[model samples]
Target: MAWVYLFLGGVFEVGFTTCLRFTDGFRNIPWTIAFGICIVLSMVFLEVATRNSIPLGTGYAIWTGIGALGTVAIGMMFFGEAATFVRIFFVLGLVACIAGLKLTSGH
Candidate 1:
């Protein structure tokens, strides 16, 4: 399903972003390669999802929402990144926006 692909894309987006942090500004070959692969896979999945009837705007909004939340989760879990209350609330707001878009889009 397109939603499945979109979700995978989001997961990959988070993976690539976390890998980028480990890449140390591209000085680390392994992390760089991992980041590149994850990014490529994310785009590929996103393209697949776009082939379906989901509206471009709705799909993109949802994709970005999931990516944003997942990235923050990865940062907090693996990168020692801050998980302030305000940041968590903002991420939840993004999730709500994604749900609202999907519900209102009639898809």
Candidate 2:
């Protein structure tokens, strides 16, 4: 359950970051509002997950890992960002690291 919340929080982190890109530096009211909602939800979920069982350090690393990976994928797929081989390699490595953390978490 805590892992679920953490994953949801990570997804919301992606949402907030994507919305941030559309916000036009907070000048776009709709996207700005969306960003605000996502960020709030993300934080709430993170707080819940961390308070439950996951350690703060591991939880934070996982959160940011998910956010970074999702954002990069979103950028490449939707925003025409480059998907270079090295970038992909590092992303895969990050995935392994995240998985390692989860497997060792003893949750």
Candidate 3:
């Protein structure tokens, strides 16, 4: 259950970041509101997840890992960002580390 919340928080972190990009430096009102909501909800979920079985360090690392990797993918696919091999390689490595942390956790 804590893992579930943690993963959800990570997912929302991507949404929050994407919405931030769409805000165009906060000039877009709707996207800015969405960004605020996403950030708030993501933090709430992270807090709850960390309060449960998962350690705060591991949970935060996973949350940030997902957010960074997902945002990069979304940027490449939708925002016309580059998809270089080195970037992809590092992203994969980050994912492996995140999975390892989850797998090796006491929880």
Question: Which one is best on lDDT?
Answer: 2
Question: Residue 39 error for model 2, in Å?
Answer: 0.4
Please tell me which model should have the higher lDDT, number 2 or number 3.
Answer: 2
TM-scores of the candidates are 0.90, 0.97, 0.95
How would you encode candidate 2's per-residue C-alpha lDDT over 20-50 as one tens digit per residue?
9999989999999999999999999999999
Can you tell me which runs of candidate 3 are displaced by over 4 Å?
A: none
Residue lDDT tens for model 1, 2-72: 88898898899888988888999999999999999999999898888877767787877887888889988
User: How far off is residue 21 in model 2, in Å?
Assistant: 0.6
Model 2 has an lDDT value of: 0.96
Tell how far residue 39 is off in model 3, in angstroms. Answer: 0.3
Error of 2 at 4 (Å): 0.5
What lDDT tens digits, residue by residue, belong to model 3 across residues 13-86?
99999999889999999999999999998999999999968999999999999899899999999999988999
Predictions: Cα RMSD each: 1.4, 0.6, 0.9
